[model samples]
Target: MAAPSPRPAGSYGMDASWVPWLWAAIGIVYLVLAGFSVFSWGAPLWVTFLVAVLGLAFLAGGALFWNASAHGKFLVWRELLDELPAPARVLDLGCGRGAVTIMTAEAFPRADVTGVDLWRSIDQSGNSPAAAEANATVNGVSGRTRFVTGDMTALPQFDGGSFDLVTASLAIHNIHSPLGRRSAIGEAWRVLSPGGRLVIVDISKVDEYIVHLRALGAALTVRRAGWRMWWSGPWMATRILIAAKPGASS
Candidate 1:
């Protein structure tokens, strides 16, 4: 097997190389569509509407396919698992393909990690329980990890204050609407123990994401990964948002 790459500096998590290419391809496709819209001065209304619809379809398709990759999973693992304490109990929301779940088990050897996902047929790729179990065995953390199929908006299997850390990596945007995302966040908040941390890493509406965290009474801190510095720099870089439940004062 190939050796794992060394972690990058000033990074709290794993480096994901494929994200840049995926974003570039999506940007190029949308730019080309916009160019066509400018050039087609006399195009019919329906034609323009069709082009717009197709562009959105392509964007969504690309995002879903990209999210299924191990690289994306690694990114989530890095952002969410890096700061957690040992012997932690972690809940991975929308744990597609169990990449993040398995990685968490391996990285935290002492922690118990549980993954939950909707497991919709369309989004299902190689992230099944069998794959996750095999990965855990290979990584020598089989005792610490497990995966379950479930929805994020309603995590009935988990009781309130059950976990030390709660994470949703690139999964929030998959919800059908803003209200759905909020409900998912609410579920996460409910499952976390007081003083536990919540981490959400995704390309979503920043304002809305922050608003949901605020509504949960969490104190938020945002960090930019080094990989995103080339394009977005410190200002608009891909983010890892960290929030904590209020803890008792000393």
Candidate 2:
């Protein structure tokens, strides 16, 4: 068998075009809050009130940015989907813009698919509930797909061992730290049934990926694919890591 070609580098990264507008908005908000602080000078009541409002705004904006980037990465879901099985139950973790969720439904017409995400308007991209619904309908697989808005760390809506496959494409790298990645992996493991499989794709190094999977009690297999290969084999290059839950007789 021919070796899979390596996926293109530099195809991943955040778009910076909106940075100017974002900064401008933040600057304007800061100025408005500063004026409020000046007017409230010695009045402890106004000072505390203004500070709290500004702090909350900042927190909300930060969250919006994070969500936007997460949603934007949904553009790459098609590449990840090629590795999954047909007629399988699929759970898309951090499914922003619902791209993979919809794609999975379409790719496996008999499968039941669910997409879970926080669905912040700013980060939703084309993977929102509405988008997922629309895509599924257009692809003639609406009946098999559902999109839900919720927390990824605690997926209470889903039952344990519910899905045949769990996918977290370009999501693991967005986690804040190593510990956060482990937590997310643990959650993925918890939801997978015995004999279920997981595929996680991120910009992370293979070693880091292995460590995280090991921590979650998963075995790992990595491969790459993309366009412009030697053409003796698979042209698509990707870093694919496949893991199965322990206790399977296979």
Candidate 3:
């Protein structure tokens, strides 16, 4: 892996990255320009109304993004860790910034967690394996955590049923295509040993994810996560799916 930047544990560590701020900035700029035009050039009243609506929307979007990505994710992951068994081998899919992955390693000293991510720049600012490594090192779990540059749809390094626990935190929804999403779910199921547990958090299409898991003959439960999962209220439509491969104690 490439050397990580010399940042504290939190350097580039926010759950939602620059995108929300960018949207808010755009809205604020629009509002400012519209206000200037209205005062100096006597722009239309509807222009003011439009800018107000758009500006508020953008601000709300930014706030929601912050709540969902940072605080809410921490809460959800903490609770999930409590619910998970003491896994010997853990696989974290789409482990951005090493939040869940490092936390998993920290929580279970016996488990060696492998974090896999495509690390797309669009997903988060400074999202990379090196950033993840830095986060792990800062958290002092670097010994138990490993960052892998790879896709969720195909995990070639890990053999079938190798992981005792699998987790994906707000990561899979970025896969816009239906096929890729299914492949990710299938690959998680395939790589886990029988009775292994899989947990996922996504903004949308988790019902489909649960369906795919059920089709694989795994026992599963789906919940519309509470406010702890999404601080923007329930309208944001966040969901969590917990599934387990058969032949293990439930």
Leading candidate by TM-score:
3
In the range 1-250, model 3's lDDT, one tens digit per residue, is 9954222256555655676678689779877877886888687989877877887777777777777665667767776788778999999998878888877887798899999998887776678888888888888989999998898998888899899899998888888899999999999999888888999988777877988988899888777767755534466767778898997652
RMSD of every candidate to native, in Å, equals 8.3, 12.8, 5.4
Candidate 1: residue pairs that collide: 97-127
Name the better of 1 and 3 by TM-score: 3
Error of 1 at 238 (Å): 3.1
What is residue 41's positional error in candidate 3, in angstroms?
8.4
Question: If both were scored by lDDT, which would come out higher, candidate 1 or candidate 3?
Answer: 3
Candidate 1 lDDT over 124-173, as tens digits, reads: 44445666566666666668878888889988889998888887766787
Q: What's the lDDT for all of these models?
A: 0.66, 0.62, 0.81
Per-candidate TM equals: 0.67, 0.60, 0.83
Look at candidate 2 and tell me the lDDT of residue 80: 54
How many clashes show up in model 1? 1
User: Over the stretch 1-250, how does candidate 2's per-residue lDDT look in tens digits?
Assistant: 9953222121222323254346446746765666666675554666756765665565544444433343323434555566555636889887765556666775677789888876554333334567556666765676887888877677777888888889876556656677766667778888888878887765444457688778777877776533211111132123557888786532
What is the descending TM-score order? 3, 1, 2
